[model samples]
Target: MAYVDSADRGRIRLRRSSLICPGDDTKLLGKMETVAADVCIVDWEDGVVPARKEEARRLTAEALQKAWRCPERVIRTNGMDSDLFETDVFAAVAAGVDSIMLPKVENAEQIIEANLLIDRAEQAAGREAGTVEVWALAETVQSVQNADAIAEVPRVTCLIFGGGDLGADLRLKRIQLGSNRTLGIHRYEYFYAYSRMITAARAAGIDIQVTGFTSYTDLDASREDAEISAQFGATGALAISPRQLPIYNEVFGPGADDLVWADKVLAAVDAAAAEQRAVVVVDGSMVDGPFIRNARFLRSLQDLIDAHDGSVG
Candidate 1:
């Protein structure tokens, strides 16, 4: 689902899970249709070797043009300074992808340059301007420092935390990036960056996604990290492998208790609305503007799930 970001609406996309498929691998791309992910990102960056960048770009463009089961399809392009960046952007725009994920963003200037390149590509291909969105990669210290500025870029729809690269840049050990806790201290290693990223995204009314937890074989650890991320207000996390998808989806999806609360809140709001009232009480709790808004948002997720599975009945 495409997430609608706004101050009043909050994060509206069920990005509970996102899968990154290596663009050059046709076999992997073929499996994308069967995967249950909110977003399928055809990666043309780290997943593809430098020598095969062109092939990856070509494959990504082709994949984007074809129909897929995933709701939101995005192409993760090479960095703005790379030789393949222009070609990646041009192909993605020409193919009319849902969005272009630009990695290693440091400032608004890079976003502006990428947006301009996308604009030129769209015009050349006779496509509508702004048809393609931009997702900024906040992996570097510089990028984290200027996160608010980057979030202000008009083409940017979301900011992704590249935990692996960011952790390395901070000289943090691999274990530190995992779900290990020392003296009951959570992943303080990423506290500063996570705080800044979330704050910037919320302030700009955009979604912020988290990516890391390289231990694909360890579902428990990944779930721990995901729980912490949710507590810190991350909209979602990227699943590097197909095996990680279920864990992420479960972690981000609303639980049974959440649904029960939403049902009550929504029912009370409906009754109040029918009575020409703006407030109501449910389970000894006041149901007002905030309660009604949250209840509707929760129901939206169920609606999306039902639509995706053709289970609306």
Candidate 2:
């Protein structure tokens, strides 16, 4: 479900729920056929163990060649600083993935360098320039700080907020059972990082703003996380399990009440315009520039959902 960017530049994808599958896991990759996520990433980064990196690359490239039900097929490449970086990028590019998730990104120059590599791969593979989009992972504190510059890159279409990695970089305490996640209590710490990335992504006209941290099980907790993420302006979420997909999608999308409100606001605005007025009051609320913008954005999102759902059905 890709749409034109708000900046009137190019296309951006709608990823209400992005399911991450381990690259080396044949079983999981095979099971991807039965899932329904807006984006399915054959992860070559943290999800792949170092011992099986080659296997992951081979499997991911193979997976990309097959037609899957998911609209956006993407891969999360290893860090640019790593030796496997170029290998991962070239393989994914040649495989014709819809997007590349560059993980552990801490600056804009790394993404620029990645685009140079992507350019070479596109030319070598005889693919169109800019066919493959870049999705930057704002995991580190440095990346969060430089998110604006990173989002400004031309081919970059999405900013994946890497809350877990950012927590690790901040030296937050993790669970005792070798989990890299900080204690999930309250989860107020990542609000600042979320704010920085959300603002940067919006400024860059990237529509698919994402929260990239989740775990398996605990459906209640997943719903809470999804609701909180939506409250913070995230349009998408990274799902560790398929069970979380429906929860994320429902949380991020406009509800019946939202559509009702949008209908009323749009009607009010049309009425006011007919009366040659620039503003109108809807149920005691002023329908001005900001109100109109919100109404139109949500209405557009609902339309996208309807079209996509109809197509898939």
Candidate 3:
């Protein structure tokens, strides 16, 4: 059965930190199981060498089956065109993974095809058809254009932006012609594209995750980036190292201040409703319907955090 329905659509929350473990690396796999990430993504795509793809797939399958107390287990498969796609999908199903992350997804048809494959594989294995959810990586121009359709795929639980591949595909250079040490031009365009993808995911009622930053050692920059993405409506972010996990968790999860403010706003809104008023004042600030909605979202985050037994902190 599907993990979420219309009633649980917006309620299925996730924290910012998702640790990406290369499926072929058994050492990393062992380490990731004990890490405090909201999700653990075993990567069978860019992280593995072509020669080791099969081995990676097998190891990832084994790791998932042996994982202890993992909150979420995801497998990032190669693109649909890759020879490893079928193996990755089958392995994930056999191992009982929480979700399958399909990279370089270009449109709705591709997502539907992947889902169909999953359904067939599940039936062949005598498991439920919709047991594993699909997550798409909107990495190409076509994917961005078809973001809404991809998110609306029946078995897709989330859509993630693959920034590195996307920038390369769009021919965005990291150099500012005259300066070797400086950042890239067209930075604004990147942000614009990110926002567009997030908008599409939200509109389609699917969760969204930002690509993992390549700099695994830089926790501060990673945290800041995750926070910015969250502010732009991204539900979570991908992480490459265990060190980055805590930062992502803290930034994505609710804080004491957020809970306190949400409580006050909700209380004020409730009193206003009881008094037959359309507006409410909370701590001398005027609030209305929109503010109430924001409060509810904050409360939802708190509820999710609590449900996870405060692992976020």
Candidate 4:
């Protein structure tokens, strides 16, 4: 476990959907400026071919130079084994990325190395220390086993489930139409892994995100999967296609009914507090410490979304 959080600093960033744009795809990179996803990752790993690694890094740097509408901008660097790994980190940090998505992170040492790399780059660029954060990718069994340790690393803001790669590693067949109907209906077989990471992340007071559901054509399936992730306590979902962004935003966004209930609960709590009462009942349910806390979280989430739209001060 990590140090207890005293403030909202530990609250998860408002990443309803994390969209990955292939670094070498200049067309997709250009479109990033208009995408509505909460976080856009210009990817140098997996999405890019080995021969185009340098080109991809250069493209990502240039894309970061452009004004991005998304609140959070990130770059996913190649794995540690790649010769371009260090350079990718340096370039992404110097390019002023909000965070770096480190692929294939197996342990906390990798996160420490990434943090150190960011430190050097930020210093060399005359930027503040810790300006950039690391989003560690836990896609392998080893990484999942060490999830809690990775969460304890300094500058690690979130742990992302690299489900596609993990599926590959496990040889679990992904969702495909027809013939494999049973497996397709199940879609995901990694809920246990997700729960393990979620438990670890919560213990460390960090955010956890779920990835995979590559069937960009099936918005319905993506929505179902994302809904399951939210139910599993994941803060966000990764989207391989822009088509999935709206689905993630819709599923993760606080609902109207929830907002109404939260508002009522908060007001009732305030009234009770002013009257020196320690408890209250609303909608035939007990409204106490825990309820108040939940209401506050819901209100804060709505406020964040409102702030994003310039609807609130």
Candidate 5:
């Protein structure tokens, strides 16, 4: 249920932008340092063909062993039901990745089994048993249905929403919404999926990450998608390209307007404290305990992001 401190060069971990790459792509793997992301996830599933899985695993192991600039390093292993899942977990754990992302997870039992395997991997590598973390993706109907239970699983720190496979699973068609725009491969169709994942992760006291906007070439589209995600309470987003990182970071992190609001709230709260008042009104709106707490949380999140960006040199 608890974790130990790892011995690697740790940075302040944030989840604004996570860059996903195939494990076997030597070019992308080599360019990891140059990518702009808060986290780097090397993939072992979908990214590689069946024939090259073993090769990808070996290369992925090597990539994990090598140092990268990301504060959090993650490995996305094959599904829990796959025969190769054990090998993927064992190799990733031995290589010292910060998290092991369990894909296509349907329920807590898979996470429980995966946790046992991760514990063994950690022990086998002579590291503290709970140091490596577990991340689960809500990619299927079953997964989305059981998201809350999965998030409540011990050591499952973050929950991700994968729309690609999910769309396929649901047989989701490109339906036209009010704007007359068909739900083209953008991160827009699954509003229900987003809400469920967000609520589940938050309810379980964990972070939530949305899959990247597939329209990588369209920065405006990415920004719009990121705004939608942030508006819906997503803490972070995945990025298929380095170009999407800035948009995600900007949209998700506190902006100038948010900072201004936070400052105003803090000022009002401080004034309220001076008057020995438990609640206050700001901008003609009620500011209570919960509202003040949210303002403080945003300020703290901004502070953390600033500190990490400062240390990125």
Candidate 6:
């Protein structure tokens, strides 16, 4: 039996929505506190212009200090090789943010280096050790290739896919419809990269998030993408706008049928246990280890939903 530790259990109790707000947008930052996202990410990588980097960092730091009740705060720093990388780390730590997101990571060494910076910054800020967590953005082919190594970093709590940058890196054009137009002709072999990252995160026992659709106006598109990622074992999806929050929350969360099945399975298990039996039958099918594991997971999800007041349903 796979036992969920206190941290993983706590994570399961929280909402799954991770909302991405531009670091420079203080108005959105203020409004986000009222939103239902479990994690709030202030993006400094692709969201800010080169000239506005400093301003965005300042605003993000200020928001972190002023915001009274952000559930989980994350700062998406510039890429590892960027000129602003060090500054981003220092600012995020000094601002007392919860986590720092390292974008465009290519391997485990980069994660180690980033963790070192975070450790030093936390010490300087008089914060306790491991006060901050690290989030790795697997955005390149090299990064995906080394996904397991990166995910194994002790400081890493979650991993996310940066789809737009990844798509550009693979030189594969986006297909609007469900069909994979690029896969039919183009030999760029990065389509399976997303699944590889998920597998790595699962192996490391960390939460994995998938990039949300950029088209926020279309709820259907966002919901479809959320469903696909959820099916692929992603715990959640990033929301670019507040409008997409409800959709992501709904799609990633446990559904009505899930609750029903969980209840039935637990009932059967309880009955079997009373009879001194190790197995039971539910819905005309023999239920055993895997079924019990899934039921426990569903119970955990329900417990999480009950604990958080921001659940969409």
Candidate 2, run of 10 with poorest lDDT:
174-183
Q: For model 3, what is the C-alpha lDDT against the true structure?
A: 0.77
Maximum-lDDT candidate: 5
* Full candidate order by lDDT, most accurate first: 5, 4, 1, 2, 6, 3
Looking at candidate 1, what is the lDDT of residue 133? 74
lDDT of 3 by residue, 1-313 (tens): 4533554455465646687878899999888778878888888888999999889877777777674444778889888997778877887788888888888899899888888789877877777757688788888888888887887777777888877667777887652211121452223546877888889888877788886555667566666667777788888888766787777777877778988989999988778789998878988889777878888988987787677766534
lDDT of 6 by residue, 80-168 (tens): 89888988888889998888888888999988887788878888888887768888888788888899999888778788887767777
C-alpha lDDT of residue 27 in model 2:
91
Which candidate, 1 or 5, would have the higher lDDT against the true structure?
Answer: 5
Residues 1-313, model 5: lDDT tens digits: 4452222212224898999888889898988866778889988988988888888878877776666777888989988889999999988988788899999899999999999899889889998868888789888999999988998887787889887778788886743322234754345568899999899888777788988777678788788878888989888899877998989989989899888888899999999899999878889998888878778878988998877768776
TM-scores of all candidate predictions against the true structure: 0.89, 0.90, 0.90, 0.91, 0.90, 0.88
Which portions of model 4 show Cα errors greater than 4 Å? 1-9, 171-188, 311-313
Error of 2 at 101 (Å): 0.6
lDDT of 6 at 296: 86
Candidate 1 Cα errors over 4 Å, as ranges: 1-11, 173-175, 179-185, 276-279, 311-313
Write the number of the candidate with greater TM-score, choosing between 3 and 6: 3
* Cα shift from native, residue 102, model 6 (Å): 0.4
Error of 2 at 182 (Å): 9.5
Query: Which 10-residue window in model 6 sums to the lowest lDDT?
Result: 178-187
lDDT of 6 at 312: 43
Q: Compared with the true structure, what per-residue lDDT tens digits does model 4 show for residues 1-313?
A: 1212323328747888888888999999999987888899888888898899889878878888887878889888888877888898888888889888888888998887767677788888777877677788898988888988998787777889887677677777553422234655344478778889999888877888888466678778888778888888888888878888888887887889989999999888888889998878788899887778878887898888888868312
On a 0 to 100 scale, what is the lDDT of residue 51 in model 1?
Answer: 88
Say which candidate scores most in TM-score.
4
Instruction: Tell me the whole-model lDDT of each prediction, alpha carbons only.
Output: 0.80, 0.79, 0.77, 0.80, 0.82, 0.78
Q: List the residue pairs that clash in candidate 6.
A: 13-304
